[model samples]
Target: MTSVWIMLVKKSRAILGFAAISIVAASCGTNAPQDTWQPKGPNSKIIDDLQRPVFAVAGIIGLIVAVAVIYTLIKYRDRGQPIPEQTHGKPALEITLTIIPALILAVVAVFTFGAIFKLAKTDDTEMIINVTGQQWWWEYDYPTQNEFGITQPIISSGQLVMPVGTKVLLRETSRDVIHSYWIPALNGKRDAVPGRVQTLRLEADAPGIYAGQCTEFCGLSHANMRMEAVALSKADFAKWVANQQAAYVAPAKDSLAQQGEEVFLNQCVRCHQVNGLMRADGTPAIAAPDENVWSGSAPNLTHLMSRNTFAGASFDLLSKQCRDEVWNAPSDVVGTKYLAGVTEECLNQKDLRSWLRNAPAMLPMYANATQLKATGGKYRGMPYLALTEDDISKLVAYLLTLK
Candidate 1:
């Protein structure tokens, strides 16, 4: 009997050890790109270091309580023994437990205060980017980013690009409802509220992609409002800036791409803009999106193919092979490989074609006729364009040339 009891204890310990190891391994998962446990920068590191010790202390306290309860249960088990009369609780023991918890809470309070101060220091910001949240997407604009050898203003959606080893401050606001921007690997969430600009400091220690989402429930398509921060090395970031600022070259005359350009001018020019394209009267064809879109503007597609993802970073633009060369490649090669965005042979045409056919069906958008009627005839996202298969083919050809 004694040998059997000892063996049972050993088995229990072994099982617990295996469980602990498995849990640790699972916490370091590679598939959860937005796992808060994986801190990639200073902001998230502050949060992790502050909370982990507190969690450890709490776990220790819980284990001590559990052991005490188990010991008492075994020691006081009934074995045809006399029942003890009920008595008043021990005042001293109660006092001790209360004091211990108060002390622990007090320690937690002090460390929490220190972390708040450390996290609040954002004066060292090297760049400022404006983030505007709307019904279904986020738009990022570099206001004073002269680094990366970029002298002109840069605007982008779906992907937020910043140079590695620098502090990028986001001045965030909303045009419609409230939305929260949270990139777990880099920093905590900050709310984007209408009429108020909130600030959050972001910094990346290395070059990679950090995925984020709108955590706050803002609208019907809130879950689909995803974003990615693409960190690039200095030289590669400069190359990206130069590419974005390069002159817009029109498609060759009489080519299918030029025909698609004409189609875009007819159906898409109201909301989308290809920079430097002129109207028939030679007037600059500035897009007037307020007439069609609810947010009063749309994503600029001037260098559309220069980006990797589309439709709020919810879809991949490059083929699997090219995308792997960017996403799964080594750090030294990531920047150079990603800069070569969406080549013709590497374009993912199937999804893009479907998206061009019916954008609202692909992504949740308040753009159907009934919803538009209810919302005073304003569309909250890209509506179905009812494009023919031939039109979709031509438009894809033209958009491919925008790079």
Candidate 2:
């Protein structure tokens, strides 16, 4: 029995030693760019500050308690000693321990409330953006931009764009089940619940791409719901807005792109809009998302290539080299690099073709017409359109000209 006890202790020590080594190794990489601990904005910095001391205190208390328990077990073991008195219910010791934890919690509550109030401040906010969460993507709408001298609202999805050094307010809600909006470099996660609005403040110290994902478990394609916050220079941001708001030009006559436009009218126009596509009688063509989509919305593809990513940002629109040129660029140059958009040679054809071929196969989606009867005829993703090779090639051509 004694030998068995010693063997068990040795195995326990070995397991504990391996765990400690693994934890130390994990802690070594503090320089990860997307790490929540490495705050890039004021709000995140405040959270970082608030958590550092809290974690330190927790670590110290845990270490102290563990040491005391270990010491008691080693020094007061029941090897040959007489049974101690029934001192478990000693009022003084119990009171001391309980009061200590209570006081610590009180102190923590004060600091936590202070940080919460601080992070919630939107009085100094200069701009407001509406963020809507659907099953697997985010929609960002700038309701008003008078300061930028823009009267018309701007709506975009897949990526959220902001100007550096601006405290922008994000009013968030959902169209379906609850989803969490999180961009680790900007601020903490905020839940987007249907019928209720939640607000989160986001600011970036410099121009760069900060990747984020829907932290809340949503549905079939939840893991594919990724997003990015692109912080641009003020001058470059104005340029982008101007470009996005520009008029959409029709494809030239007798061109492949023009032929693709015809294919789109017959196939893609049901759930998408080209803004000014003329019908046979020269009437304006409008996308009827309410009739076809579950969320009563679809991603507006007018300026699809202006952003680097597409399809809920799970896939890149540009080639690996060009994408790296934009995301990995220096902060000062990131804006200019991003505004370049996707060029003909830099387009990622493989993924885009595969996505067009079978969207539901690429990502799990509740898009089957028969399967979505439970949603009251609403769909959670783009259904498979069964495009022919010729149709897909033409669609790709037309989509590329969207930039």
Candidate 3:
């Protein structure tokens, strides 16, 4: 029995040592995009400030308690010694410990409340954007703000774009299950519950892309429900807005892209929307996703190539090298690189083709005919589109012109 106990203790120590080492190693990592410790905005800085001292106090208290417990165990071990007389309690020691923790908690509460109030301040908001979450993607809609030159509503998906150094308030809500909107460098996570609008304040100190994820456990592709916040300078943001609000240009006559437009009208228009698209009868080509999609909507792909990523941002539209060029570019040049969009040479054809060939094979979704019945014949995700290779080529060509 003693041998077994000794072996168990050894194994426990080994496991603890491994866990400690792993945690320390993880903390020392660089280029960790979602690292909460690295604050890039005022709101996140508030959180970082509160966390640093709280961690310090907690670490110190934990170390002292651990040391005291270890000392008592060593001093009172039953090693052929008679049991010592037990006392009822140490009133003074108990009172001291209780008072110390209470005082610490009081101080922490004061700062914590202050930070919360600061984060919740909306009176100073300079801009507002509506964020809506669904099964595996996020949609951003910028309301008309005349002061900012936004004359009409602009809808985009896959990434949220905002001006740097601006107090942008995001009014978030979900269409289906609850989801969380988070950009670790910008602010804390805010839950997007169905039928309830939640607000989160976000500001970026510089122009760059900050990655985020749905902290809430959603559905089938919950892990793949990622998001990105792109911060651009005010001037650059204006340019982007103009581009987004610009009239959609039709494909050139008799081009392969024109053929792709026909294919899109025949096959893809049911779920996707391309603003200003005209039908053969000269009527507007509007999508009817509410009837076909479980979430009642799909991403508006009016300017699809303007975004570097697609498919809930789980896949990149650009090849690795081109993507790196945009992601790693200097702050001042990042916007230019991003605005360049996906060129023919930089397009990631393999993944796009694979996705078009069979979407279910690429990502887990309740998209099969049998499974879709539960959604009332509505797809929870993009269903498999058995497009011929030639059709896919034309579609890709047409999509690139969206910019």
Candidate 4:
């Protein structure tokens, strides 16, 4: 009997040791980048506060439970005696158990509520960026900035540019369905509902690029609806704003770019707008009305080459090594490399060619010929304008000059 008990104890100890080793090995094997957890903004402070106390309390509770379990196991181990008396539960013991847990919960609730109110207070925001969500894309409007002091709103898409360390308040809404705007490194997710304007606060303590995706599934390409928030130094942000506000520069006369512009006006202008071009009488030409288009917002490709990626930042603007080289470096290095704007060096020509050929096919969308039959055969997101190889080349040439 003694030998059998010794063998059982040894086997149990071996199993426990194996379990511990497996847990440690599994934890070490996780390969997610360690740099992701480091937060660099005001909103990150809220994340820190919320996680810290919860983890601390959980750690304390876990330690207590572990110690109690070990003590009970050792103390109550089988001994050479009859079974101990099993008594009914004591009222005092039950009351103490309930009261302790309740007290701990109350304490947690108090701290959690305090933190919620602190983070929710958005009274002192200096600027507001109106973000409108749509199917498979995002549109940003700087309602605070006046264009050349003319008070015309500055609107763009795909990239959300902001100055570093400045508190930015986002007023978000959706056009068709519910969508969520979430940049995990910076803050919590905020839902953009169709009829209501929801507000979220964002701040970047350092100048760098942060990637985001739509948390709410909207349509065919919800997974493809990605975005980037670029935090720049004040001066660089001002420069970006100036460049964005600058009047469109027409391609040189009689160039391939000029031909591309003509092609765009003839075929693409019905859904897109190029700022500088006008009618022969020097008057603005209105885009042909397409009621099927959502919010009349297409990505403003003014500085197309200036950005690192396009088409919702789903594809890399540069080669894989180039992107890794930039993103892996520290903030200072990344800021310097990406600040100038997108250039030919970073352009993904293959994907660009594919996109110019047929955008809906390249990226999934509900813009098929059958889907558009209800809307008088008009394109929903983007049309597959039947362009010859020559026309595609010309259009791509014109798009490249947008920078």
Using TM-score, give the best candidate's number: 3
Estimate TM-scores for all models: 0.91, 0.93, 0.94, 0.83
From the highest TM-score down, the ranking of the candidates is 3, 2, 1, 4
Best by lDDT: 3
Per-residue alpha-carbon lDDT of candidate 2 for residues 133-250, written as tens digits (9 for 90 to 100) = 9978898888868887556887788899998899999999999889999999899999999999989999999999998889999988889888899999889888888877777787
In model 3, pairs of residues that clash are none
For residues 90-167, what per-residue lDDT tens digits would candidate 3 score against the true structure?
Answer: 999999989989999999999999999999999999999999999899999999998788999999999898999999
Worst 10 residues of 2 by lDDT: 22-31
lDDT of 1 at 81: 82
Error of 2 at 143 (Å): 1.4
Q: Worst ten-residue run, lDDT, model 3?
A: 1-10
**Candidate 2 global TM-score:** 0.93
Model 4 over residues 304-337: C-alpha lDDT tens digits? 6666777766676666766776666687766667
Model 3, total clashes: 0
The regions of model 4 sitting more than 4 angstroms off are: 1-36, 59-88, 146-152, 279-281, 288-290, 372-380
Candidate 2, superposed: residue stretches over 4 Å from native: 1-34
Cα shift from native, residue 93, model 2 (Å): 2.3
CA-lDDT, candidates in order: 0.84, 0.84, 0.89, 0.73
Candidate 1 is scored at a TM of 0.91
